[model samples]
Target chain A: MSALSLHGIRKDYGEARAVDDITLDFPDGQLTALLGPSGCGKTTLLRMIAGLEVPTAGTVTVGGRDITRVPAHKRKFGMVFQSFALFPHLTVRDNVAYALTIAGTARGEAAARADTLLDLVQLTGFGDRRIGQLSGGQKQRVAIARALAQEPEVFLLDEPMSALDAKLREEMQVELRLLQQRLGITTIVVTHDQREAMTMADRIIVMSKGRVEQAGTPQEIYHWPATGFVAGFIGRANFMDGVAQDGRIMVGGVALSLPRPAQFLTGSAVQLVCRPEGIRLGAGLAEVNSIEGRVTFVRDLGPVRDIYLETRLGRLVAEQSADQSRVLAVGDRVHLSLPPDALRLYPGLPVTLPATALAAE
Target chain B: MTVAAQIGPMAEVPPALRWGAVVNLLLWAIALLLCLVPFGLVLLISFGHKVEGAGWDWAFSSENYLRFFVGANWPAETTSLYLGQLYWSMRYAVVAAVLAVVTALPFTYLMTRQSRRAQARWLVFLLATLSLSEVFIVMGWDIILSNNSGLPMLFAASGVTDWLKDTGWFDVLRDWGLANPRNVKFKTSEFATVLTLSYLVWPYAVILLYPALSRLDPSLAEAARTMGARPWTVARTVILPAVRLPLMGTTLLLFVFLLGAYVAITVFADPSQHTTAVSIYENVRGSTLNAPFGAAQSVVLLVAAGAFLVLGQRLSRKSQGGA
Candidate 1:
């Protein structure tokens, strides 16, 4: 049985539908990230699976048992909130043992269990300390220990690393992922940070406007985005509005040949999406499919260098690892390559053309 | 009368005192004299003796304290009557304050969870009720709980009293001093006094607990729920523990406020069950012309109230320091 399965779950807050007909299955013993921007309802979807929210339409099943109407308490799914939410009054031990103590376990057993769970999160001797005494990372570890005390069937976290500073966030992400994998508990995380999702999630579901645009592995999401929103949201994409024709696509007045003919009819409007890294750069007029352009700017991000160009088609960015031999300065005329395999086609509309598309070279 | 936190260890006049040094010194001298006058009078009166056919005479005497503690003729005669009144004052204050705080806690939590606009509306309502005169609240409860009208009348009119009588539950009500032989009654009873006193401080309890409960981080309780706690468990393990200090502090505050309750006890308590407040009122202004004895009782009440306040402060400090 899948660890948790949500079937056509829909949640509507009055006239507005916060989560629109989301059907997702979290595989056993793997962490999945519901990745989206703000107001995308990724957090709402996670809350529903945790039973904190009641779906307007459809059922939630965990371990093959229908738990659609089960209240949050009975579902017993442990969750870590974005804020860490450590109880201020209780010591770390009492907070971790709360679930067990409230379940009517003996105090000794509950405290012992709490100590072991704290140890699992690498906060053993720190149990005697109050929550306010700990640093942000330690508090986050305490939250994790408290949530994991129940040994829940599915673990849920909502932007759990957002409380940490930029440096610590990346470190905790890998540590948390390793812990999740070792415990082998199915987990779901909701986050807007794409890098964190890509780092921790075995599968990533990209959502926008309360609907899932695409759900797949991080590589699939980054490399083969199924929609224009996914293509734009997952990473930086250079998009060109064009028309599909016989064995080629025409963007503005420039006709580019594809690897094969598109299923889209000729003259049909489409969008051509490609990652910045896939486009190669070299001197003027070096190869086929090379577009003549001037290097308007160059952004050197340490190991990777991005060369911005302005061409007839439009402004576009090409990222290449900084090389010891080849150096392209600003205003240098160059030819940029758009490999056919690296390109994706989408239906063009106003919303899909994000600010990144219109960003100047 | 006492100003809390008025004095600290380190004190030096700052440049913020806009009035020049002489003017500031004069102002402080006047303020200090004015604030000390009433307390000085109370102390002086407590050591003075009432003179027959005259007003009073200043003299050094332990007579007033002895009378307040035991009775006027203590060496030759024994009487515990006045001490019993003081005991009831403490008893009623403790029970009413605790009841008020315990009930106000959940109500305040729910009130805090409301949106800011709703919270503002609630604050207006609570403040309005909180600032209302104690005499008016006593009047309202008196009307509601009096035997001739209100709850008793409603009970009889709705057949509840008859039902209780038929079910043999009237005996229980009678045992609780909440009913008479003919019908249910509340006047001149401990129940009435306690109920009225709790109602008097109920709004105060909410007001005292408001800032603490309102400023409470709700994310903590929601987080506990996410950890698989039931509603009751969340309340017990998360909510209750979080508000313990506020709860104790509010109770102590209400207790001090109720220590000097005047209207409720006078109206509801039996003559034999009258409290120290009644004795103070009698000696100060009513039938008894023993001003010194009344001052002595007032001093005792003040000491009790101050002691409780200091204890509450120490407890709150310990809790916050530990955290």
Candidate 2:
């Protein structure tokens, strides 16, 4: 059963629609990530769910009760902002106990609850410290503890890790995921970082141009993207313009077969995407789906090597493990393989190769 | 430990640095002379005795201070008139400062929520009003509060005075000293005095509070709301505590400013309720020709202002330390 659902939510700011016809369900006790680039309406959608922004149309139901017009304070949905938004005026303990204190809880009980929450977030002894005294990661932990102190039915976070350093961000993602699971509260996190979303979310909803491009499990979003934008956004993918012709995608006179036959008319314009890791680079044994190319540049990222290749089809990047025995360098001739199972075809205007790839060529 | 080692870096010091130090010392000397000499003269005169005639001679005496605490005719005839004036000074200043700040707090908070352009426009308007001379403001209020043509006449013309009489509020207003036998009168009343004083400082209160309230992190309030705090609760928990120091500091500064107010009190307050500022004016150049006594009263007012300011600072500091 869904714990919270937004039915055909729309928000219009003047003539511009910030969130256009978004309908989604958050499964009970599951963490759903609203993933998008900046200004893609992910934050707006989250605000609408929190009752901070009223939708121009549609209803918001939680556990089958319509709460479309409920105010934010009455909704009691816990939220952590991108800046953490910790109260600098209050001590850590007071900040964490704020919701309880304002809700008319006894002082002694609220203090005890704050201490317990501090312990949960691994900051038990730092309760008396001011917000300014904590490190970025510690502040984020305090924000999480404060939000959860209310024991809200639904928890929301908007880009909670954007303010932290990259190393601390990854650690917090795992830590927050563990905490959310232990509590079993429904959660929605809005973030533009794909790795952060994939690391913490049970399901990821990809948004673009104020619309939901795709919504699925993280694995599904990664391994099987339903659109070119999703394939490019979730992870790195090399794109090539092509035409669907007779059960194959034709790219610059090369007919690349797919695991499944093309589902478009013969002359339909199409775009094909191949993940860099899925492309193999070496002196190949099979001629099927093999292309001759010259290595233009090599980027050695400790565990893997990214080989930039210029071929008749277009500029492509192939990722290979560093442990592979074949050593390739710039200006070296190579054979690149586009495995049928890894190729994804979408019907759309053909996407040009990225400038970085072309510059290397 | 040779002289060369001492002068090692100094030998390379630029000419601009040398000139800068000399200029800085000169500026400090001029500032001290300009700012401190007048106050030093006032202190000196405060201790001097007034002569018999219109002119006074300098002579060390503690009579002025003694006269301020008790009456000039000490044990024979005692009165608390000067002390009472000082008390009214503090009372009116305290109330007006607090009233202006309490009202300006919400107005400033709302103003900060506007766009930068709008905030600038408001600042321009506030500053224009703030720079209006005190004499002009007092004259304006004097007319508006006069019984013959202003609020009292308007009330009579609008039948509000008659309504008050019919509702038995006329007797209550009379008891409060707000009305005479015929109709409502505001001149020479504490209400008129406080109202004009509050209006005098209202713009200043807004200007002083704008920066702190504007820089407040709005996300903190939103975060409070999401955690089940209503708008008022958010303000109490998040906004108020964050700007507490600025609020106290602004109130203290406004209070000090009001302590020096002269024209408004003279124009609006009853003779018995007039403040030290009015007495200072009277003894110096008004009816009484006692410069030394006026200087003494000025010193007392300065001391009172200083004491209150220090007390306010200690309070703000104590609250911050406790937090």
Candidate 3:
């Protein structure tokens, strides 16, 4: 119902800082995702907001009311844990109505409200079953219903879809987004899945190393990642370490230009990022960013074909629509153009992505 | 078809599986020899008659069983002395077991919350304590509870007994038979007996409750808390219900184990309030030398314990069904 804001929040566990000094405001009735990799402190931030964890330093306020000292029980923030955490001893109805019953609502009224919430989650007639009888997705629904039973001002979910199968995760993502929209509650979801964040969050806060890397709309984050880490983390990017020379990046003795001139001191280390789709194959030789290369490998994924190129820019990847008239194959000679508008340039060297990152895609 | 065809795939079973079957049969044989055979002998002996002056005779007489319920004189007289001892046994076991579990529940929960290494250390320490013989523990408690040397002397030395008298609390203790006219007396009372029995089984209670409490997902309680339940409410509504079965099971197991407790009962309880186990020992191996009656008492005790176990199991099952 109201905006939630955190100011200068920092969490320290002995010598290690889990969440550093960070400030952000969650807009009322909008879904914001705290997106990051494993151990990136996104969950820690979410727990602080939920009042399940107290920040070692800083203040949490809801609509200008400081609640940093409040315990989770008093805050009444409905939270869905990664494991769902449904009470196995209770029936589905009781699980869903937990908040209401615990808060002293009449038994019949709480049961009625639980059934209504279950119906909202498309789990009608499942009230009599035990928690152990429900499937993973059903249990998640029960958890969501239980958290929402009190109509909490803030809704928090930590990796809510991580427990579901791949196919079910997508379905529940859309369903949960719709439910959040219908309720119009200020919701914060912490997840590592970029696609999940892009699909559901109105604004995504990308985090790394206990700090916020970038906070913006998903489109903005994808199109204009502020750092090489964000560029590599948000989506697949072909990274090339180079030196900024006169508003351009020189990688492996070849120069790449950006739409806007790179604002870095000349001869300083820089990283050039270009989405695979941003590279165009078979560009005219006279084009500004054109380079000739041999196709090292070809991957045809039905809708698109990713063509890996051995170029002066150090192993560039270009994605072409599958329906194109000319299909490039391995060992084919191709002229690729790194579109100046699509190339994103950031100061410093490119991040070294884990080798398993490629397989995860 | 040849005999090989008749034997077929069964003969092709893996060697490991065959060895497992052999081991299982050996286990069953050992169980029958070590458990069932002795029980069968006791039951058989229980039905025999006890000789007046010497050892028992193997005769098909129901007098020993009748004497357990009523006096041997039957129509001429009736007494419930043995039955009273059985009652004391049941009462002490139930009370002590309940006490042990009640006290251990909080300790075990707190212990489980500790770091894994700390929990392991505590468990190892408890298991080491279990190695202490019952006689040793009883002797230790006996010295501690002795009037001249231990708690009573401390009470007198510290002026606590005088303080109790000044505050008029000494009369309350006297009314409860926990104090004489002058000072507190713990010996020859149900309080000492129950306390010692509960202490004897306390470590077992913690060990029994450890797995259930440790395996409990902490997030369940956290979820309850976030749902507006206070800490106490969370414990009552979530933790207690989740471990209800384990708690009941631990209590019942301790109850059954304490049923035949010999040393603690003999040392702490008054002679008039002695349990069935003490009486059985007295009849068989002590001054009475009545082996048949002892065997009869043993059978009755075993049946009583088994009946209570079955009853507890059924009650837990019914509660589970209701939940």
Candidate 4:
């Protein structure tokens, strides 16, 4: 059964809708990530589930019970905030034991439980330290320990890794994921970073403009995006506008076939996206959709090389492994391939005219 | 070394350093004259002997201290009159400061939750009331508390006084000295004195607490709420503990400020219940005309204020260290 569910949740502030008609379910013992850019209502949706926000018009259900009217304190959902929000006046042990103490637990029992939780988070022997004395990662661990001390039905985190440095954020993401899996608690994390979401979530929900763009497994989201926005947002993709003619897409008069026939009717405007790594560089034996272009820029990342080319179709970026012996410089001429299986087509008028058409004119 | 390199920045250093030292010395001298000299003169006069007619002359003696502790005719018969005045002074200041802070705490917490524009408006209103002269404030309260016209007359006009008499609560009020022969009177009572003193320092309490309460991390409260803490529990466990030091410090400061209050005490307190501040006025410029004794009282009040300040600092520091 789904542990928590939000149905048609909406939050309207004046004329602006912070969260618009979001309906989602968090499966039990699974971690879900609400991923989006800044101001995309992911945090708002999370807050509504946490009972921190009252929905304008919707019902929230948990385990077959309607808890829409329940306030935050009554819900007892453990949440780790972006700032951690540890009480500076309390020692680490007291901070972890706060929920237990407030719930009328005995001091000895609460302290024992706090110690166990601190051990769970690998923060042993640091119980007597002040909150201000902890490092950023240590503070985050204490927050997690405090939240888990309640053994809440649902755990929520809002940008929990944003305050940590890049290196520590990645490590904590993996560590948090392991801890959540071991406990098998229903958890939801709100994050703007796609990599973090992919690393930690069992399922990822992509949101934009206060609406859910797509929700699926990370691989499915990466391999098959339901919208042009989702495709561009989830990963780096080179977009090209074309018109569907017969069973092929015509891009600057070069007809490129898709793995499956175009879904849109002939003569309808369509957008095509291909991942950079899917595009092969240099001449191949078969040249079905090959384009001649000059290299305008070469970015040599340690593991991969991104080759920027001004092609007849458009300005396309192609990626190659750094281990490959092909060394290309700026102003070098090259032929790029757009494989049929790697292309994704969506029906929409192009937002900007493709550079190929501008060159053709 | 090269001439340009040697003289480039070093040549300008000596004159600037000399000018800075001169300005620093001048500021220290002025500070000493303006801040310390008057206090020194007060201390010096505190030990001087009071002359016979109207003035006092410089002489090292402990007569003023002796008179403060006991009666003027010590060793023969003792009187705790001045000591009683000192006690009333501390009692009134303590009660009024505590009442003001307790009341202002809720107001300040609520005010800080408002928008900046609304907070600014509240500050303006509070400052306007805070700047009102003590004499004017005392007069205003006097009109409200007087037996002939204010609350007592209003109670009579509204039949509440008769109601109290019927309920036999009037006897209790009379026993407490809050009522006269026929009607309930508030003037010249401890109730009226402390009330007016609390009102006088209430705005100051709000202003002093504004910064600490406003800077409090609201997320801390919400975090507690999510941990299954009720609103009251969150306040007790999170908000109160966080602002504990500020509350104590604000109370101490308001107490010290109320120590020197003159008009409120003189107008509302009975003559026998008046504080050391009123006694200082009587000795300095009133009928007594004894300046040295007044200086001695002023020094005592200053010392009391300083003691409370140091106590507050130690308490805050201890709390911080314990945390």
Candidate 5:
């Protein structure tokens, strides 16, 4: 029943606004990720929810009860910091038992609960180890166990896997997600890595410049970005800036038709984005929305090959599956088509085009 | 076979190693001559006998040590006069050192939380204060604690003394020996002695504690708070435990530094409550002219300080192990 919700949360640091007015709802028993680049206010938003930072103007409610003015210690919302902030003086057992012990739980009962949690995190027999004796991954596991010892209604993690290596990070992401679902505790994770968000989040909130640009399920956001910024940030998107005309976008004298006409008035600046995998290159493709292109470079990524092309519209990259029979090398001529359904159009010119696109022009 | 071949080139010492050895030898020589030599001379002089109305002579005797523990005329009359001075010395140093550390800790913790620029400014100000000689600081306090021109006068002029009398707290102050019939007094009192001693070591305690406290992760406290501990609990459970070693270390250093403090005690403390340091000064260079007794007193003080330091080290180690 502890569904956390924020209304009009804003934070200002003297003359600068670190977090803008924004409202969001985190449903019960769901995991949401606040995904953004550095300085995107995602961490600030998480801290505000944890009651560590007071919002300039907002109400933070849990299960319809406003806890806006409550201090962090009284909120009962457990948070894991980016640095894993484990107390060096305490052993792993003492660390995990801290919340219960502080609340006057008997020593034996707290120790038993800590043992169970250590086993849950697969860190059994590590209770006696000092913090300095553990590796980075082990320390993060201890931090997670300690945070969950309170059985908080809302569990917050700020870049929980950031200190881990690539392989370990991926493994821990799945492990953490499974644990969260089993516990069915409402959770919110703040991370800058897009893959990390996509891997573990039930819903992803993409933020930029202190404002949420879009919030939806990962698939919805990835396949249908709401803005040019979201499209560029979420996944690899080949962007082409153009002017909207009668039912089409004109880019470098080429009219690329959309599945449906854009809602913008004619002569308005617009940007079209297509995923690299959406660009079809072959001998026979529909003439409409197709352009003749020359392969400029080839990149092999073990599972897929990326082919860079110079087209009349601009420079573009196309992803080719490894199993594809035909292989395109540099200087090869091909016809690439932008499927009308795959091209997402947004009003306004892109702030900056790709360097390759600029060079091609 | 390869290991053997590799070890062949390492059999001979390189020129750099040779030069480093020479420098190490030179440093040891300097340390022996500068530190150990004087310490050996002090120990040697402690056992020597004093000549009548003259300087000390080089002859082994335990008479000075006996005189310190008992009296100069042991068979007929015995008094623990020097032992009492030693007790006062220990009492003042221990109390003053603990007081300084207890107060400096919170101030240092707050300073560390300030911005880097502010912290730097505060550190510079503390270091600047360190340049004030002990004599100057004692003189300043002497004036502030004097009855005619200082706090006693201020208390009389501001009517706080009369207010205390009205509230009957002035009788309590008189019972504590803090006031006379007229107004509050501080001169030649234990209160003034400890206050000035604590003040003299307060800056040193802050400086010694700054590095450990500034490096303490603020997140430790925040983490404790998130775990449902209140601010006071966080300070007790987390912050204090994290800096326990440094706190003990700082206290011990200030204790040793205060053991020999002469100027503050001489100015603020009553003549009957003077420390072993003052006794040593009187015996050696003041009117008594008994250098052997002075050297014996110095040795006793040094031994006491060493024993306490070792005990403190052991306690800190045990606490660390327990943690």
Candidate 6:
């Protein structure tokens, strides 16, 4: 029942706005990721929510209580920092008991509780071991156990999987998500890795330049991207610039049609978005709204092959399942189908990208 | 040495060329020799015997050892006076060194929490004061506690002497020998000697403990704070236990350094309350003019210092191994 909310939050460091006016919320018992490229204010927003950083102008409410000025210690929100931050001097048992002992619990009782929590995190016999003795994954698990020792109202993790290797990262991702789901703790994770965000979060908040560009389930953000930036950031998308005319957009000699007139002013320039996964290779230009191009490169990624095609409109990369009957190699001529329904259009500017195209791309 | 061409292959090198690795090796060798020769001489001379009048004889003997332990009048005269001075020397060094490290721990922790620029500036300031000669520090305290220009003077000038006289607290100062008939005085007092000794090593204590305390992960303390510790509790639980080893090691090194102190003790201590270093000075180059006796005392102090250093190192190794 304790949901965390932020409204019109802004954090400025001198002349630069690290987190420009951004408003968002995390419903109780749900995991939301603040995803973006580095320096895009994702971590800044998460730190603000944790009360570690004070926002220049905004209100942060947790369970309907204003915590805008509340210090981090009083918030009691368990946090796992990127480095794990386990106390090097303490044994595993003492680190886990840190919360209970500090809160005036009896020594024996605190030790017992620490053991239970360690057991929960699967670090049961590691009590007497020093933090430095543990592997990267084990240390992160201890960090998680230490954070939960206080039974914090909300959980916060900042790039928790980044320190591990690729295989370990994947395993911990599933383990952590399952742990979060089992506890039903309201959690927020800050990460720039889209795959990581997609793996753990129930809803992903895609952010750019200190603003929430789009917020939705990972599936929604991936399939029905609200902006070109979302499409490019959440996954890969091939973009082509053109001008909208009636319900169709002309790109060089090829005229790409849309299901309806893109919501834009008449005669406005636009950019069209088509995902590589949806584009079919070796389909004749006449078969669908399509383009004719020469293959520039081919990437075989085990199960699928990415065919890079160069056209007068520009270069586009399309993914074809490796088992597909037709095979395209680098420098081979191929036709790519750009169906009208799959193509999302947005207005474009001469310099900056069109706002609508940001969602579609 | 200045003309490379004149010195053969070592010479045909450029003017700066003699700065070859060979020269670096020679430079290092000379550096080690410069530092070690005098101490080596002291070790050799500790075995030599004293002659009549002014000079000493060079002969291997255990007389110096026997003299140091039981005294010159020992099996026959029965004097433990010099050995007793050595005992007080160790005692005072232990207490003052421990006191300095205990106080420096918190101050160093606070200093490291400051920004890097601030830390550099502080290092400069502390190093400046730390490298200052001990003679100067004793002189400054000489003024402050001289009864005419310092704390006691201000106390009397402000009627604190009269107030203490009325409150009967002045009796405690008198009983402790911290006062004369009219007012409180720190001259020729243990309090003044210990204070100066602690101050002499206080900066050193901070410098010695700096790297360990500075590199301490801030996140660890923050993690403890988030776990519901108050500021004091965080320091007690996280900071203190974390720096305990360095704290003990710093104390031991400072104690070894303080064991050889002479100026502070001479300036502030009564003649009857003299330390072993003063006695060593007398035997080596002062009135006694007995170099062998002085070398024996040097060996004693060296042994004490070395033993403590080894103990500290062993303790550090033990802690590291356990970790």
Clashing pairs in 4: none
Cα lDDT of model 6 by residue, A192-286, tens digit: 88899999999999988898989999999988888777777877777888877666788876777777766766577887888888776675455
Residue-by-residue lDDT tens digits, candidate 3, B123-159:
9999999999889999999989888787988999999
Candidate 4, residue A109: how far the Cα is off, in Å: 1.4
RMSD of 4: 3.7
Interface RMSD of each: 1.9, 0.8, 0.7, 0.9, 0.7, 1.9
For model 3, state the Cα shift of residue B267 in Å: 1.4
Between candidates 2 and 4, the one scoring higher on TM-score is: 2
TM for every model, in the order presented, reads 0.93, 0.95, 0.95, 0.93, 0.95, 0.85
Residue B113 of model 1 has an lDDT of: 92
Higher-scoring candidate on TM-score, 1 or 6: 1
Error of 3 at A192 (Å): 0.9
Model 3 chain B weakest lDDT span, ten residues long = B4-13
Worst 10 residues of 4 chain B by lDDT: B6-15
- The candidate, 2 or 4, that scores higher on lDDT is 2
Please report the candidate that would top DockQ against the real structure.
3
Candidate 2 on A1-361: residue-level lDDT in tens?
7899999999999999999999999999999999988889999999999998999999999999999999999997999999999998789999999999999999999999999999999998998899999999999999999999999999999999999998999899999999999999999999998889999999999998799999999999989998888888887888888899988999989999998899999988999888898887777446778988999999998999889899978989888899999989999999888999889989866433244322321
Over B1-323, each residue of candidate 5 has an lDDT whose tens digit, in order, gives 79889777657778999999999999999988999888889889999988896788997899889999998999689989999999999999999999999999999999999999999999999999999989999999999999999999999999999999999999998887789899999987899999999999999999999999999988888888888999889989998999999999999999999999999999999999999999999988898889889999999999999999999999999999998
* Per-model fnat list: 0.74, 0.91, 0.91, 0.87, 0.74, 0.62
Q: How accurate is candidate 4 locally (lDDT)?
A: 0.90
For model 6, residues B1-323, the per-residue Cα lDDT tens digits are 55766665642556676668779999999999999998999988999988879579888897887888887876888677778888878877988898899899889999999889999999999988967799989999999999888999999999999999999999999999999998899998988988899999999999999999998888777777667777888888888878878888788888988899999999998877788899899998899888998898999888978887888889888876765
RMSD (Å) per prediction: 5.6, 2.5, 2.4, 3.7, 2.7, 6.5
Clash pairs (backbone) in predicted model 3: none
Assess each prediction's global lDDT (C-alpha) against the native.
Answer: 0.85, 0.91, 0.91, 0.90, 0.91, 0.85
B116: Cα error in model 3, Å: 1.5
Clashes per candidate, residues 3 or more apart or on different chains? 0, 0, 0, 0, 0, 12
Candidate 6 has a TM-score of: 0.85
Docking class of 3: high
